[model samples]
Target: MYESFFGLAREPFSVAPDPRFLYLSKQHRDALGYLNYGLRRAGGFVLLTGEIGAGKTTVWRAFLEQLPPRLDVAYVVNPKMSVQALLKRLCESLQVELPADADRPGAEADLIDALHGHLLLAHAQGRRTLVVVDEAQALALPVLEQLRLLTNLVTNEDKLVQVLLIGQPELRQLLEHPEMAPVAQRIVARFHLQTLSRDETEAYLVHRLTVAGLTGPLPFEDEAIRRIHRLCRGTPRRINVLCDRAMTLAAERGQLRVDRALVDQAASQVFDLPGLRRVGPGQAARWVAGGAAAVLAVFALTRLLPPWQTAGATVAAASTPSTASAPSSPSAPVSAVPASALAATAVPPSPSAGKHVASAASPASPPPVTASAAPLPHGLQPYDSQAEAGDTLASQVFGQHLPESEAWTRLARRWNPAFTPTADPCAELPRQGLRCHSSQGGLGPVRLLDRPGWLLLTGPDGRSTRVLLEGLQGDQARLSLANGRTLTVPLLKIAPWWQGEFHTLWRSPPAYAGDGVLAADGASGTWLAQQLARLDGGPAQDGAEGLALRIRAFQMAQGLRPDGLPGPLTLMRLNHATGVSEPTLAGSAAAR
Candidate 1:
């Protein structure tokens, strides 16, 4: 109704996930990057959670559009299906043929077989299969278990099917349940979408209006924007609802622009508040006249008081909250909902709230490693809630990579004095000639080490999962999983969850009792120069000054402390950069 009044071509505040009006905030961009990482992985699980109406669907749609043609995607918008029903749906999605003569169990078997065949064909053709289950939080435990079992269908190196699960914040909690560890352990990439910030919310509104063919200034007054933001709490859906109602009310009042009064009146109507009733223009005029008279009376009374009393009265008046408007706070980007807005009241906080705060980082104190991304090793998958893959992790790190169950079997058979099996995989790394080093700030130190390793990903419940780092490619890292998949994640995405701990296998360095010096014309310095030159594509030189500058420059490139000294972190990275071939006794510890 307000489209023509505001000179818009169409409704600007529709609550549809229209890609045309979608705006990518920083969080959204991060979420998309995670999604892309999931897609690039061979096959595993990608878990995405958000509060209701945080634009998960919009981001999903945008991601789907950009997916490569080699990937075939099947979307499950409703996840409340039985195992058999889900199997049938999967068959329908993948276009697998099912025979009519089969019973429910038989049909399920048929569907699985057909899907396996189809996926194998796709694999042979160098294609990929993805099944996206939306509203996954509502999936039954049995069905989730069934989905986990489906991931068991794999080649020696990759899973036949990749699953993408999208749901609300509740899904995160659901995954934290001990019963869901099997499913939870498969998630290689997880990202939670947050609500828009105040600025993003304002930009979202303007972007919508412009998309709806409004080329002039925004129809909303500055005060109206603040009122809307306060009521909507930076949620795009609620913002749209309040804005739509505000515009409707404005059109009803025959106004060309929406102001604070219209927004308040619209909020009252939208929220059904008993104290805030919509009034007519005549009533508003009378209220303004009455307020003016009251102000004049107060001014006269204040004039009779002493100067200090008058100033005190002025301060008190300023302290009073105005019903007409709210002073906008310094725009906080966090997702918060004030109780005044009925719609926003339904939106929950993002899972892992405030975990993304960059300010929590300190240079001296690094974060802890809380999560891991090791995929399910075959033969030893944890079917029970209490089962820990500690023995398997030991085998993967120390012994050869065996399937989870097989790894346990191998651990028992090849038990060595150095290997003590425990439920916690990372409990006893020191015995295996390895050490766990943690840095607080970021990946600069990790990159300086530059070795394939595992990260302990901490969940909200304090349980840690292991994430495997296969290699680093510039600013991103190639992470391998137990499910035979590899994810290329940007360092920025990892920063949010990285607790600053670097855990991997490192050989003990030879004893050297000198100040950490890596640049000189000596044997060690010449080797360091040659390694740095080879690693960085520069000319090999052994001069102390030139090599020190090169070392500093290399440190800077890896996001590490760029001090000129080739410290332990730099030496470790250089040792890894140069393959371990005929290593000098002192430098041999740096080799993986």
Candidate 2:
């Protein structure tokens, strides 16, 4: 219905086992290789299995088109029958005529005799007989055992007939049974087809569209493709269903492009889910900013507690009754009074006590504590050298499959929003409930943070590279690149680019409560300017002029208006820029 409306010659998404429409993805190619190997070997069974609608039959049909002339083929589409009925179906597939008047026992014996004779005759004629059973998972144990016994017609060199079993994943389970050991042992080649990757899914759609006679650009947008891949899990059958419905919906609406909304509407109808809509960029920023604020508030509260407590204590002491005001010593601890008596006797300090309060109170003496000097999270080991830290960090991201080794994979899995490989790692960091703090301080400051991070390195050729700083040993630093390369460099041997610009990924707190005061005069402004300086990978500046210049530079870099005033969005970006981990949207979580 959508073909003509979309200016196509044919329907691109017909859910049939059409060999011409087969998209040979990596898994499909591998499966075809396995099937070809079985045919060449010709002495044993070849097993092919996949999830339902994963294109097992389509792959087999593609295989059938390339069959050699020397191979005599018999295709069985249905295998859900008793042994006698199965044998009859097999005979019928081979075009062998059965005896109409024969008894049940006689007919069974005759069928086997004829099949064995027919295979031997084909072998004598320099041809191979191959039987392909579709949905073999439905075949009973007795029927399967009988098929296994048929392989006994083998000659001294090779079997006269080969068998190929194709079914859903259940076929693997059936073959794993102890009773099916003989059948399993004879299988020379096996492959389980998997769904396509996102890239492959996109290509598959285009290929189908081209085959259906589209000469123009693809109708689906990139975001639409992404959503389709996510909702369909890269299953071609489901993708076909969704795309077909989406195309029809688009046609009805007179829309030329198959946009994200129509794709979502089609998916909702097909999958029986609610309609999905893209979150506005502003809304997403708010969520990320909210999370970041929570993180800052947590650390800020911890940092400011001493000052707040000291001030509170000073006020409390000033209000305490003097030795002359009551029959109790002013130095007595509050705990000295019985709980019941204290609760009943507690009263507000009188205005007269205010006269002596200032002279007697000195509780607000301790200095404020900053979180910058706080220790790293537990279990995060610090390195003495930048190179050592980078190597250890690299091993975690690009290393082999080791426990607690695949750092990126672990973070990606834990992140609220599902991340695709194509996503910008830096841009998605905030949505992951984490932030990336970039600093231009030397290895001393980076190491002082005592957290794993990605360090920006500039080569002698002026090419920028990123290395993971995992840990350190003595004076040597462990650094690793995305390509699985590692280096152990002494602190003194660090590169010029190692001028200390690095980004760290870390967790956010459970909640955030704050005044959101980022750009203020005095100390807070200085702190904010320092953070912006670090995020800019530039020298720390002093006074308002330097702060404004740095803020404008950062705004320009982030593609924001260079107003020099840090607004909510600017503050959000600043927080993310100084955050410990990459942030990604919780779109997947919201969808759920």
Worst 10 residues of 1 by lDDT: 337-346
In model 1, what is the error at residue 31, expressed in angstroms? 1.1
The TM-scores of all predictions, comma-separated, are: 0.52, 0.48
lDDT of each: 0.62, 0.64
By TM-score, the best candidate is: 1
* Model 2 lDDT per residue over 1-592, tens place: 7788889998899999898788766477557756765666667789999887789998889778666668888888778877788778777877776767434664778888878887777788888888889999998999889888887678788788789999989999999999999999999888998888876887788778878888666789766888899889988899999999999999999887888778888987788664354456876676566545544544454456675453444334334544323233233444432222222333423222322343343454332221121123222223322234345533333343222224343334434346554235545655544544455655433433445566655555455556666555334455555555455544444544466675655443323112232444576566665676564444554677667656655554343456777654466556555763433221112211
Question: Model 2 lDDT vs. the true structure?
Answer: 0.64
Off by over 4 Å in 2: 102-106, 274-592
Worst lDDT 10-window in candidate 2: 583-592
lDDT of 1 by residue, 157-272 (tens): 78888899999999999989999998988998899988776656766776788789875567787667877887777888888889999889888888778898788888887876
